[model samples]
Target chain A: MPIEDKQKPQRNDRVTIRTVATHAGVSVAAVSKVMRNAYGVSDALRAKVTDAIEALAYRPSRAARGLRGRSFTIGVLLIDIRNPFLPEVIAGVNEVLGPSHYQAMIGVSDARVQLETSLIESMIDYKMDGLILVAPRLPSEILAKFAVQIPIVAVGYHDASATAFDTVNADDQRGAEIAVEALLACGYRDIEMLSLGERQGHAVSVVRQREIGFRRAMQRGGLGSSPAIGKIPIASPKREEAMRKFLSRKDRPRAVFCWSDLDAITLLSLAMEMGVRVPEDLAVIGYDNSPTAALGLVNLASIDQSGRELGQVATRALISRIEGRTASEHIFQIPSLVSRNSLTRSGSGTDMKQG
Target chain B: MPIEDKQKPQRNDRVTIRTVATHAGVSVAAVSKVMRNAYGVSDALRAKVTDAIEALAYRPSRAARGLRGRSFTIGVLLIDIRNPFLPEVIAGVNEVLGPSHYQAMIGVSDARVQLETSLIESMIDYKMDGLILVAPRLPSEILAKFAVQIPIVAVGYHDASATAFDTVNADDQRGAEIAVEALLACGYRDIEMLSLGERQGHAVSVVRQREIGFRRAMQRGGLGSSPAIGKIPIASPKREEAMRKFLSRKDRPRAVFCWSDLDAITLLSLAMEMGVRVPEDLAVIGYDNSPTAALGLVNLASIDQSGRELGQVATRALISRIEGRTASEHIFQIPSLVSRNSLTRSGSGTDMKQG
Candidate 1:
């Protein structure tokens, strides 16, 4: 065979709408109507067009369609990718999006507000169908302003009163409360919370919500209104330093609840280095129920909020909003506790001996 | 401000390329030439157009530009998101792209070749400027075919013979040799390797390269050419089962080398569970030296390849290719061993006690 004859038909040589119309012996408008599933298309015309499409293996150009309308691409903005919890959310998003015509394009902002803003703008400029912002650090009002340009569903954001966008959260306050209650149930009287240190305490931040829950649960348990809450710096060096200081402190609490499993696992390492035994000298509970926390060596008790489920719910909500559901929905899912050896020696339930 | 006034100055009120041309008192073609940095644009014209752009805060629509030409966006394809090593590479890519006009959009292929091919096609369809595939599973010929359509730089792929695309990798064979040499220097003659089990071993894969290095190093150290190499399943239940089986085997080697820290850390946990002590009963070393390996409770000795540096180099190479660097460049960096408690009790250097 000649080289030209042997060459297979590539994407450039693909069948177009015109070819489908010609093959179906119908006008281009009729084929277009059938392709869009418009109301005016007759059953006979639809069947003819569909048969031609199947025979010709025609795939409409997404870029060309995107120039005119929806791109069928959802942009997912992640604040940071280092956390293991974020990958779980991505898995959930992919799970929900796999069967649909829609596809996801991810942008990592690295927790920088400027980069996050630029990424959102770029997504909108690309004419994406919708966006899912996972644990965004931007204020609610700013998010509301952006939501006016495109449909948005925020996962891990705590805004409930916003009318422009939907919010899906794991109920961080409830998660923190569960963590504290588990620690209290384990018969620990001297307990404190280790929280992320930030310049401002925004109501929309999950960290602040967790902190609020920690205080409320502590107060409800008859602990003083001013229970100790140590702040851990977000940077690695300072984060380790603060954990070390806490471990070496003479007045360290009998039990501690960390805002995230990332920090709690580090605390476990530091405690081991400092010769302070878990559940024997210092008990620990963390949020997020990360995979590392489940390791036999770490064995950390944690609050499981299920980031994957949050991603699934957020993607569904975003799709609905994109398809013209205007009313804002603020959905919340309660979290539960996973008991491990770090909480108590039995590793089954709370041992009710007072500290 | 009245709501009507606020609404009037929304999307439509924003500046555009035509507005920039008008503000600069230049022709639209001249402004376009200046934006593209095409020839025949005077310095004065470029300066005026830039000033106008800065004054109006005009950002050219990426979607509109994508229809005609480059989108100024780079696509990053990750085989899997769960591995900690992949994130380091992303951090490096982001670091290099942060100061440039290019932005990275990531796609998770979930280690499936079909998904990887689709994601690559989607990026090309989107008219992205370039692509950086981290540890892709695609064959060299397929990648070369895709290279005809778009610029590609593959990190962790070991195909230096390919002429179409650039590859940046840590010397995996040398990395394996370093690990084996460290183990040999500790005077352990009975050593084995735990490698990933796949349906077929491709020469382009990093795992296959590491295996070759492991065999060569074992033979150089006067060990028999048929040294024991255990194959570990990649999936969860079976993976652990394989490690547990190896740990309990009466004829197991005195020391072992693992393909990755992900498996090594798990093996350590299972070793503790099975009443086998590290270094005393079975010395172990791993690759990648991931952050988890550095944890005090799970300090596994391993080779450090610096995935972040590989990412940075790959991004630079991709950008250079996108900017018209035609020659295919293959870059390699050497990896070193990080001694830890898993290899010896001292956690400083190898304990040269013969076994």
Candidate 2:
């Protein structure tokens, strides 16, 4: 066979809408109207068309359906996939969409701003009914411009003032405050926070929000108004190097709170290798309460903010906006602390066996 | 706005292919021909259409494009998202597709057979150029049936005999043999393999292939012909419970090879809680040298398959099929062992600091 001929799309004999119309003894127009639930479709005609669709096992082409109207597909844009917390959110979204007529298609941006923009535009061009962006890198103005093209709900983005799109978040400020409060309750006066280092820090980002909360909580607890906040590089060798430096600091705080479990877990491992006993030498608390934190070998204290719950809420919000109830709802869920062996020897945390 | 009105799809004034044609002072067919790179298109006409598209920022509707020909989209189906190893595969796919016009959309089936079938059908209906299914649960015949409609490349599935689709895999049988040989070299005469407790055992599955290799290597080493292969449940409570039971067994082997890092890491945690020291009492080896396995706290010895490389090879094979290849291609990559503390104390493995 010629290569040019092979390049042509392969044709498959499938049950089309026309086949359903013929089986129902109705015009193609009537069948289309009934499938769309358009006005002026008689009850008898709808019943007949529905029965024909079922009997023929006809699946309407998503492409044609998208061109005419709704595709029943939801686009999910993820900034990164390595974070274990993101998968929990996806599971929650799947739980809600499993029985519905909708399906989710995910696009990973790898946290690149350019790729993120193109993906969002591609989803809009696909005629997807709605989109759920988790930890998107775009600014609020850019997101608002795109929101005009489709119904969008963002998770982990702390933009409550935006009127164009809905936002669902686990209160990062409160999460950080809880981490500090836990350390304070343990009688640790000198405490510092370890946060992510970004080239350009956006106020709307979760990292900044946690920083704000960390400062306020420390001031309220009678610590210095400007408590020490260490910056950890997000990538590999540098990230580990930063953690090691923190561990070797002669004036390292008595207790430390990490912005995320991704970093805190690594810090614990480095601490162990450096002969720094966990609670006895340096008390540590982290955020996100990831599955790894609960392991018997890595019992790091953490703040519990349910990623699944955030996903469920974002999906519901997006659905509402797609259904025409859009008033730009911004929802927040409180995060609590999950104490473990890293906090203290007899910390009142859940037993490792259950984890 | 009324509730019913809100349910209607919102209208957006997106630039269309027709707009590009108008801007280029050419017919829609001429612009479409240029976009598709169809034969008999003049270079002058193609250049004009391309320039017009750039100036107008016109993105062709994916739905309309799919209806006429290719959507320039590749669909990726993942069995589960929680597994850390899956992300590496996605990274590999994205790396290859980054500079090309093609984009990838992922669908998570959560290991459900029914959902996997529907997602594949949906991708076909969308007129996606090709598909990459990772550890799909469908039978070979069913996949072959779908293969006629679209190009498909399956990762982690061991179906080299199927003529309809391509497959990419890490040499699972050899991977298991390497693990056993490593154990033997460590002077461990007693050993066992922990396998997944699935409802149905398919010879094509990677799990069963590992079992075959495990038995062969053990027998070759003068061990019993029928070596003990304990089945570990795939889910949470049951999975942990099985590990605990194995840890408490009085006649447990001196060393064990787990089917995956997911189970091996959990087993290591259980051993720690049960006061059974690693390498000292229970040497463990796992597959899929996942990030967690390399962690200092985990330090699990595992087979290095390089999921990223598998994903890259699979994508290249799928693109070849889409472009014109007809013959089925089954590619394999040899896996090696990454010795760690879990295998033996002072083992000839990479140091924990580097990990």
Candidate 3:
């Protein structure tokens, strides 16, 4: 085959709106209106444009469309990709987006505020229709500032008071309370909370919210005036060291609630290494019922916030905002608990109904 | 703060090549030449442009740049994100690209070929500078066709004969041989391999390469020419069922080599449930010595193919290709074995130095 002839099928011949217009014997504006589904286009004109489009197999170039208007692509910003929970969120976002014309392009920020800001800026520059930021590290003020430029729906970020952008969360505070309640029901009075040791503390963070819930729940249960909460550093070696110290502590609590499954699972592993028995020595519960927690080997008790559902809700909110819904919606889903061997010897705790 | 005033800081004022030229007291063409690092530019001219760029703190708009030329962003296509090994590769790519001007945007194809093709097309339409496809499902001919339009570097894909693109991989066949050799050295005469069951088998897949290595190693060891290779379905329920059936088999092999740690770890979990002792009744080793493999609890021996290193090499290769290194290069890195409890009762196996 000749090179040109061979390449002809692969190379897309540009099918402009003007081509559709000419084929339909109508003005270019008419075809554009029909494509956009504008209010002005009549049914007859729409049918004609549709017929012409079908005959020519007109597929508009996203890049060209992006240059003018919406690109039909939603950019998802993940704070960290290493966490198993994040992939579930991505799956949820993809599920909602798969059927629609919109496609997702993911950017991992590695939890750096600077990189997160830049990725957001890049998405905006790309003329993406909207953005879904999963557990963004940026402050509410900074996020509010960015939200003005484009439609944004932040998942796992707790800022209901913010009027700029919408937020869809799993009620981290309530989730933490549920974890504590599960522990309390199991007759574990002495309990401590393990939380991430971030340099700068922000009230908008889910970690902070969980801490508040833990404190409140402890107070409500009359366990202690002020329950001790251990701070686990995010870096390696030190993270394991903190968990080991906690495991071997002389005055360690009878039970513990961890901020996330990422930390909880590690704690479980280290506990096993340290000759500590789960539920017997240290009753444990974690947040974000990740896949690893459900493993027969791990069998960890976890609070199920459903990251997938959060992603789905956030994507829907972003789309609605993109469609010009001005009123910001702060959607919160209730979380439940999944009982397993980590909490009790029976390896079955009270199963709460999923919300 | 007033919304309009708050947004002022973020709304980027476009800085064109003309602005840089005016500031540096040079022509726009000289600025473009300096930006591209073309041979005609003098040191003095480069210094002037650099000074102006520094003074203005000018960051080029990727979208506008993409419309005209390079986007300074590389798109990474992942077949699946759930796999733990994939994240290490991403980390390696980021480590290399972090110091450079290029940023990475990832698209997950979910192991669907149609989705993979469309994602690749979208990246091209977005005008990405290059692409790094990690274990892509696309065939060599299709990939070669795509390579004609952009620079491509494939990791975990075996196509050394292709002249259109570069491939960076760990010697998967040799890695499998090492696994079997380790098993043989432990005096395990009867051995089997568990491989992913794909609907349409492709010879270019990494799984096939590993299977070929397993067979060759078995034959070389004076074992039967035709070794029993079990097909484990990729999905859940069925995957676990197959492993359970194998574990319960009366004529089950004394030892087994799994295609991935994902499967091997699950097999370990199932064996524990079914009361099948590791290294006593059945010995097992897996590929991709992932973090999970290192856990003291699930200490399964595995082929140590550093995904991060593969990612780094692939990114470097891609950058080279993008920078006009046209001759297709195929790079191979040797993989080593990390012996653990699953391989033997003592949890010790011959350790080879990693390449």
Docking class of 2: acceptable
Note the DockQ of each predicted structure. Answer: 0.30, 0.46, 0.32
Worst 10 residues of 3 chain B by lDDT: B1-10
CAPRI docking class of candidate 1: acceptable
lDDT of 3 by residue, B1-355 (tens): 1111011123545566788899999998898888877888889999999999888866555666787788899999999989999999999999999989899999999999999999998898788899999999989999999898889999999999989999999999999999999999999999999999998888888999999999999999989899988999999989999999999999999999999999998988778767787878889999999988887667789999999999999999999999899999999999999988889867233221100
Candidate with the greatest lDDT versus the true structure:
2
Docking quality of model 3: it rates as: acceptable
Clashing pairs in 3: none
Ranking by DockQ: 2, 3, 1
Candidate 1 on A105-202: residue-level lDDT in tens? 99999999999999999998888999999989899889999899899999999889989999999989989988888888889989999999987776
Residue-level lDDT of model 1, residues B1-355, one tens digit each, is: 1212222233566466877777787777888777777777767888998998898878887877776677899999999999999999999999999999899999999988988988998887787888999999999999998897788999999999989999999999999999899889888989999999987787888898999899999999999987888899999999999999999999989999999998898898778767788888999999998888888778788899999899999999998888778799999999988888888777333322221
**Clashing pairs for predicted structure model 2, backbone only:** none
What's model 3's lDDT at A206?
Answer: 95
Candidates in order, TM-scores: namely: 0.91, 0.95, 0.90
After TM-score superposition, what is the CA distance of residue A69 in candidate 3 from its true location, in Å?
1.3
Candidate 3 similarity to native, TM-score: 0.90
* Better by DockQ, candidate 3 or 1: 3
lDDT by residue (tens digit), candidate 2, A212-275: 9999999999898799999999889899999999999999989999999999888888887777
